[model samples]
Target: MRHLSPGELIDAAEGHAAARATAHTEACEACRRQVASLREALAALRDVPDDEPSPLAWDLLAARIGRAVREAGAPKPWWAAWGWRFAPLLMVAVLAATAGVGVTLWHQRAASGSAASAGAVPGADEALAQDADGDERAAEDPSWSLVSDLSAGISLDDAADVGGLPPLGGSERALWQLSSDERRTLASILEAELAESAAAAPIIPGV
Candidate 1:
């Protein structure tokens, strides 16, 4: 017994509702009046002709849209905008760092070259010849083998303590004729020289 809805009333006005809605419209005076009003409104709408839009209005709308689009233009990307702002500074920083590193490396190489020249020995050839003589002496006398091994990497010029000692080139037989005290003193001196030589010896790699 509920009153008819607006959609049912519209269907009733258009003569398109079910029989049940028609029966309700007949029984309900309120629904009947609403349907009559809807029908009258629809008839009035049909009687009045719709106004057509002018071509000038459409052309103006299109022109406004085109102008807006042109004004907006394609926006630059966020990174592109920021990158342009800092590009020169970033390039300058990179170049400066590269130049500084190059200068530092060049200075290091120059310093190492100067240090090598400063540390070089003028008597390198003479020392090499002395080592070769020591090698030959070691081969001839087993006693000199210990001396050769102790003096392997050590320069003969560094042996300041033993430099004052006389040469034993022809004094081997006279060594047995020395006094007891002289022999003991000579043995002590030899021991000290050996110890000093061994202590001053340089460590050779892979030996």
Candidate 2:
């Protein structure tokens, strides 16, 4: 009960059957049925009318396929899709970072200036003690007297306003013209005095 292969049956359906194949299909019911089915299917396909595409339809289809292929193959630009949307956010971030750095630098410089002023303050006090010609000049400026009073415990509010010293705004030229060593001494003394004050001050609980 050996049967012909499907390939042999298809060949027979196409009318290209070998003599042996034809004989086998004729003798075998299964082979003959398979061959008949293939023949009928093939005949139906052949009988169906060929649909010819119009020129415009082919052109449009080709254009769409070509566009799709080009889009898929082309490398996409990062900025093109997202740059405009995120550029402002990036700029704002950069600005914020720059401002923060600037503020930090300003604080550092102000601290250095304050430390320098604190050092210079004691020299001005010494100037007040000395019978120098600058005494009359120092007395002339209203701001000079405040520096002397800071040595005597004045309000912290006043110190904050004066920036840890009286407003030495180029009024008394001698006060401005302190030597480096004198400034260093003034700063050290001021630091020691401040430490003593902090030690003496009463601490409030739950602060």
Candidate 3:
């Protein structure tokens, strides 16, 4: 007796040719056993439900895909679109701050310069007054020729001393010794000298 092949048994179990295979299985013991095995395998396969996705699962998948597509197509915000809009404003703010700082520094520098010039004024004025007095004395006296005498015997130490007075000490001392009028005059001369000196002095960069 010829036994049914496993493939034929499987086809028979699936009811592909139910009547003909049923007859073959009942007559042949080997074919009957093969059919039974095939039937068991088919029963196992049937026990597992079909893996086709449910309608709810399909909707969830569609929603996720739709969200991804929408995100990909969405336009950027206005700020992102025109990022350079604030750049000029930022630059202006920076420049304004810098200018304010520069103006403040300039005013402070001017005030400092004014103070320094004020301090130096008296000494310069006293020196000028002494020179003028020497000139006047020389002019009035034939015996005391100011230019020749100043050129001949006057050293820096002697020149530093004016009139019948002792050497002018520091600015403070000179100012202390002078009358109010003399002090004022000395102050003006010192101011002028300081202005000249400030003009002549080369500016040192970066305090």
Candidate 4:
């Protein structure tokens, strides 16, 4: 016959075994010894009183529990984890928005200043428009038409005479004798001076 299990021995020792287990313990010497040992151990445990903690031990336990509960290990919100993932993108977007606002404000200020300047000067826009048109026309026509009053003493034929003019100055003759590279460099310098003068000159509406 197989030996009685620990559960069967426990049940027999506690007076709660089935009839078969009780009969097995009765017939088996080893099962009877096991049941007796288990009964004695259970009786010894029952004799001992339940332990209650001392006041200091209770206080220490409570403090340890409180420390754990009040600890600074606060978990981050659900969005906080995702925020780090997009931090660079968020920063870039913020910078782009700031730059856009700055540029828009700068343009608005520039336009307001231009409007104020135009308002302070009467016919300023018209004068500028006229000057631009005159420059375009001058560029298209290389020839200058003589005014009757300005050319009072000279005929059209005499105006065309090259010998009537004064001889070239030292600087003028030197410019005419410049090599191709030197001429290009000199032309660039003259163009720069002309541009500076044109920028500095004030526009007169009728002139």
Query: Candidate 4, residues 2-118: lDDT per residue as tens digits?
Result: 778888888899999998998888899999999999999999999999797786998899999889977946756534544454355445444444543344345444554676687
lDDT of 2 at 41: 97
**Model 1 segments beyond 4 Å from truth?**
74-207
User: What is the overall TM-score of model 4 with all chains considered together?
Assistant: 0.31
- On the 0 to 100 scale, the lDDT of residue 122 in model 3 is 29
Give a tens-digit lDDT track for model 2, residues 1-207: 668887787789999998999899889888889998998999999999989888799889999999999988875454433434334544543444454334434543456567578884333334323323434644553444444443345465654543343332222343334554554455456557856998878798455
Off by over 4 Å in 4: 48-50, 75-207
Error of 1 at 34 (Å): 1.8
Tell me the number of clashing residue pairs for each predicted model.
Answer: 0, 1, 1, 0
RMSD of 4: 36.6
**Which of 1 and 2 is ahead in TM-score?**
2
Q: TM-scores, in order shown?
A: 0.30, 0.31, 0.27, 0.31
TM-score: model 1 vs. ground truth: 0.30
lDDT of 1: 0.57
> How would you encode candidate 1's per-residue C-alpha lDDT over 156-201 as one tens digit per residue?
4433333431222224323424454554454456546856998888
Clashing pairs in 4: none
**Number of the predicted model whose lDDT against the real structure is largest:** 2
**Candidates 1 and 4 compared by TM-score, better number:** 4
Candidate 3, which segments miss by more than 4 Å at Cα? 18-20, 50-55, 66-207
